[model samples]
Structure formats: structure tokens, C-alpha cells
Target: METPIDRIKLSQTAKDQLLKLRRNTKIDQWNILCRWAFCRSLAEPTSPSPVPIPQDSNVEMTWRVFGGEMSDIFLLALKQRCYNDGFPTDKETLATQFRLHLHRGIGYLAGDPNIKKIEDLVELATKKI
Candidate 1:
């Protein structure tokens, strides 16, 4: 399957948030943290607000790097999300929503007070939503 986005560039805010998450969770890879953030946002009941996020940070990754072995699954989930949200699944829309969801999810994770360690992250993933 063709991915809607080829490259992802995060905002400075997201970069900072991921840095904090790194310290808290001891997970060093940006791609791993990004995967978590993307899934976290997707789990939300409402669509992410269509806000503009500046790609001002130097942090960048290819879709393959970001998704690793789960690239196709991530793309499928994104397409399904667009369909469920009543949005077109065109590449442009998918890319836009991907950015919005990613940023929102990063913010959600960074702001959560309970995520103090890697186990907290696991607990969060296992918790009833």
C-alpha cells in the first residue's frame, strides 16, 4: 500500500515533548515515541482539531523509519480513521490529519501526569479507555 506521507517533520514543541518523554520513559528513539503518540491520538473519541503545526524542529523521519515494521498497519489505521471521521482518504487529507493527530497525541502524552516511567506507559496502554 502506498503511504499518504513520505516524510514527517515535527514542530519544536513536539520535539521538546518527546525529549521529556525520553527522560521519563527511558525510550531514546524518536520513532518509537512517535508511534506511541500516533496511537494515543487515534484512540481518542474525537478528531484532532485542525490546527496549524509548524515544522520548525530539526527532528524529521521517513514514514518507514517512523512506522518501522508496522508501516502498513499505521497507514491502514490512518485511512480507517479518516473514513470514520467523514474525511476523504486522499493523500493530502491523510497527510494533514496525520500531522494533526501526531501533534495532538504528543501533547496528550507529554501533559499526562501519570506517565512517570516506562511501566506507566504500559499501564496507560492497558488501561480501559
Candidate 2:
């Protein structure tokens, strides 16, 4: 099977943010932190900005590690979002959108001041951002 995403490479700023998130939320795993970041971006009502983030950090993970057991569901959701956004579900589009949304989400999650505890993650699902 074609990998949903070959690898995820965070910008230096994003890597720094993820480190802060790890300390704040006490989640040691990069994949789990990234999952939170990805979902946070998806929860936004607006489409993510398409700025090209420089992949200048060493943080890289395969799609399998990032998605864990829900990888298939995550891929379907990504494809659905692409179709909704009038983008094709082609490989390049998927990869690009994944990076955009993931980075955007990471920024959002890291910047929120209320997310200092693991239980605060429920806010991502319940609170009206």
C-alpha cells in the first residue's frame, strides 16, 4: 500500500513548540503529540493557511507511527477533507494538506494558554474555539 504520508518533518519552530507541549502536557511521545496537533488543526472551522513551512528540524515519523491504530480512519478523514476543499485525493495533494494542517494544528495547540494539563485536551473537543 502507498504510505499515506512518507514522513513528517517539523520546522524548527514547530519542533520547539512540540517540546513545550511535551513539558506542558507530559506526553512524551512525538507521535501522540503530533496527533493532538493534527486534530487541533482539523477542528478549526477555517481552512489552514497554505504558507510553506520550512522542514528544517530532525523530527521525522512515518505515517504509521503518527497515525497509530487509527491510521486508516485518519487517511479517510484526510481524503474527505481534501474532497470537501475541492482538492484531489492524489498523493501530492494529500501530503501537502497533511503538512499544512499538521503544522497549523501544532501552532494552535502550542499557543493555547489553557492547555497546560492533559485533561485540558478535552477542550479541543468540547470548547468552542
Candidate 3:
């Protein structure tokens, strides 16, 4: 069966941000870093901007790699998030929300100063942004 989320690509800014996050967290895989970014963005209370992010960077990954073993769960959560945000859960909307959340999460990881270690990600659970 075809994956619901086919491919993920970052913008130039997000890619740069992910580079910083990779250095800080020492998690080398793009998919792993992206997973952190995805969940980080989801934990936030505000919805991501609906503005479309340009897919201008070279970084790319298949949905399976990005979501790994929990691919279905991640896709379902994303679709659910779209529904919760009062948006349609159609393919286009799902893809857009996924990109929006991914970029926003990357920004969250890159912009934080205290995220130098992997353990610091746990702080996201307790700290208010």
C-alpha cells in the first residue's frame, strides 16, 4: 500500500535549523531529528501558520524513514491535529499540516538555547515556551 505521507522536504531555513539541532543533540539521522521536531511542534498549544513553506532545500526523506515503525500513528496524529485545528483531513491538507508542523518543530529545536543535549528534550515536557 502507498504511504499516506509520501515524502518530506525542508526549506532552506528549516534545513539550517536542523543542522544546528543535529549538532546540538548529536542525533545524526535526519529522520530522528525530524521526529523530535515533529513531536516538539505538536506539543505546542498554538497552531502552526498556514503559510506554505517553500520546498527549496536538498534534504529529503520518505515517509517510512521519517515516521519509522510508528508511521501510521504519526500520520493519524497529524490528520487528527488537522481535524482539531478545524482544517480538512484530505490529502492536501494533511500534507500541508505535516510540513507546517515539521518546520515549526525544527524551529523550536533550533531556537532553544538549552537544547544542547538529548536529555534536554525532556525539558520540553515541563517548560513553558
Candidate 4:
């Protein structure tokens, strides 16, 4: 991705603002930015939203009215379930939650695993060859 030129340029005010943000923030803010990029990467400008809305409503409302959020919605649902279940959201709890989804999600993302072991794979390949 190209670095967008700031019309404000490298003014002292911009530099100071960035320094303040860095000191206050714990995590790298750049990775969070990638999520916005990933979401935008999905759709094209040519394919407009099916439902149009009034001029007054904001962009967030615009998305809520006409668009679907695959990633953000999944995360929001995940947190909501965690909230209801009273889980601490630590490694163990997350692992258990992940297992429930992973088992099903993997089946859809990857083809069904017929063989369980590398030995089985080698045996099958040798027989075929």
C-alpha cells in the first residue's frame, strides 16, 4: 500500500500529536488499521449498496442499513457470547471457545481430513505411485 501524502505535511503540530498518541497507546495502532483495509478490500465501488438512505444519517448508519460485516460482526458476536458466559477471556477460555468454532470452521475452510497421520499419507501415496 502507498503512504498517503498528508496535506497538512510534517508540521510540528502533526509530529507532536503522533508522539502523544504513541506514548498513550500500548499496542501497535498500525495492525488495527490493517483491519479497516482488509474490510474495504472485500467490496468494489462499482457495486453500490443495495439500499440507499437519507442524507442526514452517518457512515456507520449507512453500513448498518445496507451492508454486511463478516469480520467485525463475528468478533462482536464472539465478545457478546463471552460476556454472557462470564468467561475471563484468557488463553484457556479462548482456546475452548476457538475449538468449538475451529472444528466447524475448518471443515468448511479445508476439505475433510480422510487420514489422521503422516504414515497413512505415505502409505496411500506409495500405493498410488
Candidate 5:
């Protein structure tokens, strides 16, 4: 499956949040944390806000790195989300939605007071959506 985005660049605010998450969860790899964040956003019932997210931070990763072994699954999930939200599956729309969901998830994870360790992340993942 082809992904709409080739490269992923995060906002400065997201970078700071991920830094904190790393210190708290001890998950050093950006891609792993990103996968968690992306899924976290996907689990939400509401659509992500459409506000523009500035990619001013230096943190960057290829789509391959971000999705790792589950690239196709992530792409399918994004496509499914777009379908569920009554959005077009065009590259532009997919790309925009991907960014929104990713950033929103990061914010959710960072803001959650319960996410202080890796086990907390696991608990969250195991919870019913």
C-alpha cells in the first residue's frame, strides 16, 4: 500500500512533548512513540481539529521509519478513518488527516496524567476504545 506522506516532520511543541514522554516512559525511539500516539488519536471518537500544525521542529522521520513493520496497517487505518469521517481518500486529504491525528494523539498522550511509565502506555493500549 502506498502512503500519502513520505516524510513526517513534527511541530516544536510535539518535540517537547515527546521528549517528556521519553523521560517518563523510557521509550527512546521516536517511531515507537509515534505509533502509540497515532493509534491513540485513532481511538478517539471525534475528528482531530483542522488547525494547521507548524512543522518547525528538527525532528523528522521517513514514513518507513515511522510505521516500521506496520506501514501498510497504518495506511489502511488512515484510509478507514477517512472513510468513516466522510472525507475523500485523496492524497492531500489523507496527508492532512494523518498530520492532524498524529499531532492530536501526541497531545493526548502527553497531557494524560496517568502516562508516567511504559506500563501505563500498555494499560492504555489494552483499554477498550
Candidate 6:
């Protein structure tokens, strides 16, 4: 089993932007984008695939594709922190902390706002291909 679709997929706006770029450049758009992309999974893995998290039982999946997981690490850290804290009050400080974690979480919530400065860099790396 996979996590719920919690993040955003590439938006139509981004597609429009890409279309504009392709038109302006008068080029085969996919060619340029493909060169820089690093795809994670084009579909769900087969029966013997590594579990995304240890909590999940062995399972097989079948899907066409999904977004990258740049933010997963940071989100995990945030989860760890939250679990350790035993559900602290939802304060601004806590928000800030989570924000920091999300920054590093690559598109952690798919189109979610990045918490760290690095997200922008990653965004550029994946931008829209």
C-alpha cells in the first residue's frame, strides 16, 4: 500500500508555463526537460519492492506514476519530532519547526510550500518536465 495522495501533482499552471516555454523556444519541449529530470517511480513497484516505510507490510502496487519524494526525509524528521514531543501545543514555534522540516521535504506535500531555502533549488531541478 502507498500513502494517500497528500501532495500536489504538477499543476496546470506549470504545464501552461512549460507550454509557453516550448512555444517560445520553438523546440520539442520534452527533449530539453527530459535531459535534466531524475524520475523516482514511474509506477508502483512490483510485489518484492522495498517498503516505503517499515510500518507497512509487504505489498505489491500498480500505478502509472507519482511525484518525487524530495520532502520525505524532512517530513519524517518532523514526524519523529512530533512523536517524541507527545503532541505539543500547536504553537507558532512548533509551526516554525515544522516549517523548517518541510523546507527540506522536497515538494514534501506535492506543491506544498517549502520550508527551507533548499526547496527552491530542488524545485528548479525538477521544475516541470
Q: Which prediction has the highest lDDT against the true structure?
A: 1
Q: Report lDDT (Cα) of residue 125, candidate 4.
A: 36
> On residues 35-55, what C-alpha lDDT tens digit does candidate 2 reach at each position?
888888877777788898899
* Sort order, TM-score high to low: 1, 5, 2, 3, 4, 6
**TM per model?**
0.98, 0.94, 0.91, 0.24, 0.98, 0.21
- Residue pair clashes in candidate 2: none
**Any residue pairs clashing in model 3, and if so which?**
none
Worst 10 residues of 3 by lDDT: 1-10
- Residue-by-residue lDDT tens digits, candidate 6, 1-129: 232223223334334433443443444433232112212111112111222222122221211122234334433433456556554534443434332332222122223333223344346556566
List where candidate 1 sits over 4 angstroms from the true fold: none
Candidate 5 ranges beyond 4 A from true positions: none
Which segments of candidate 4 are over 4 A away from where they belong? 1-69, 90-92, 104-129
| Candidate 2 C-alpha error for residue 59, in Å | 0.6
Cα deviation of 121 in candidate 3 (Å)? 1.2
lDDT of 2 at 78: 84
Candidate 4: worst-modelled 10 consecutive residues by lDDT: 1-10
Q: lDDT per prediction?
A: 0.96, 0.88, 0.86, 0.31, 0.96, 0.32
Candidate 3 residue lDDT tens string, 1-129: 355568887899999998898888888999998998899898877899878799899999999999889898898888778888898988887888889999999988899998998889767757776
Q: Which scores greater on TM-score, model 4 or model 5?
A: 5
Question: What does candidate 4's lDDT look like per residue over 4-120, in tens digits?
Answer: 111111223323332343343322342222222222222122211223222231112121221134544634544445455666555455434423432222222123143343343
Cα RMSD to native, each candidate?
0.6, 1.4, 1.9, 20.6, 0.7, 15.1
Q: Could you tell which candidate, 3 or 4, scores higher by lDDT?
A: 3
Give the range of the ten consecutive residues with the poorest summed lDDT in model 5: 120-129
| lDDT per residue (tens digit) for residues 21-102 in model 5 | 9999999999899999999999999999899999999999999999989999999999999999999999999999999999
* Model 5 whole-model lDDT (C-alpha atoms): 0.96
TM-score of 6: 0.21
